[model samples]
Target: MTSDRARLREENEALRHQVATLRQELTCLEEQMSFLVNLCVASHRLHETADRRELLGILREILNNIVGSEELGIFELDAKRSVLSLVDSMGIDPAGFQSIALGAGVIGHTALTGKTFIAGDGAAPTGTGLEPGLTACIPLRCFGGDVWGVIAIFGMLPQKPALKPQDRELFALLERQAGLVLAMTRPD
Candidate 1:
């Protein structure tokens, strides 16, 4: 009887451990599913319209709702590729970022190299129209490996102090999809 009781206790403990592990895995999966839903919604919204103004409005909503950024600027690369001009913005003064020359600062560098630059990594915004505290610069790249625009996030919303790993993933999605959508939606 003693041996049987010990065996039962060990089996009970093992079952409890298995249950706890399953719970942890379930939580992680739920988080992943939630993130996936966000991605799906963002992608759907990006391709939802062909109107320029409406597209920009949807982009603003994505920035505000999904990206957790209250302040952001969307810059379009000039046909000559020499300048990035602020085409649209939200939650901040656009006077400082009226235009940026290619390779001049973080925003320009992002446009020049197609690299995303997140703040707090020894990089700062400099040059003309880039004085506002920027949180990140995401290059909008097209299929041919050309960067045609940049999405600059300035001081993420007050609730979000910093970007998360998932935020980077979402940014990557935007980099891949936003440009193509814009190109398709542009008027001839």
Candidate 2:
């Protein structure tokens, strides 16, 4: 009887472990689902309007409400000189970053390479602007993968501590979809 009881206890423990693992996986799936929903909503809002100001407003909302960044700038690339000029920003003055040359700093390099540069991910050379608090530079690329601009996030909201995996997904969504709206709404 004791041996049978021991076997049952071992089995119970194994079952519990499996249950715990499954629970963790379920939580991850739920999180992913929520992220997807948010991305869809953001994309829809971005394309819902053809007005440049309205699109910019939606972009800011995504950066602030979803990505948790309060200080950010939308830069337009001047490809002739390989420069990125700040078009709009919130929560911080953007005078210093009005123009940034490609490969000159984090933001410029992110635009040039069409890569997202998150601070602390690596030793990214910082020099263009918004130093001491520059958090991320996300290159906004259209379907062809040509980077047309950049989203420079200088600071995040107080409630959030750091960027998460979901934030990266959102950045990617913005990189792919956000640029299209601007391109479509381009002025003649």
lDDT of 2 by residue, 1-188 (tens): 99999999999999999999999999999988988999889989998999999899889998999989889999988888888888789987877888888888888888888888988897887675455588888888875888879999988888997999889988888899898788787777
Please list the residue runs of candidate 1 whose C-alpha ends up more than 4 Å from where it truly belongs after superposition: 1-10, 120-132
**C-alpha TM-score for every candidate:** 0.85, 0.84
**lDDT over C-alpha atoms for residue 125 of model 2:** 75
- Residue 123 of model 1 has an lDDT of 52
The lDDT per prediction is: 0.85, 0.87
Error in Å for residue 88 of model 1: 1.2
Q: Which stretches of candidate 2 lie over 4 Å from their true place?
A: 1-18
| Candidate 1: worst-modelled 10 consecutive residues by lDDT | 123-132
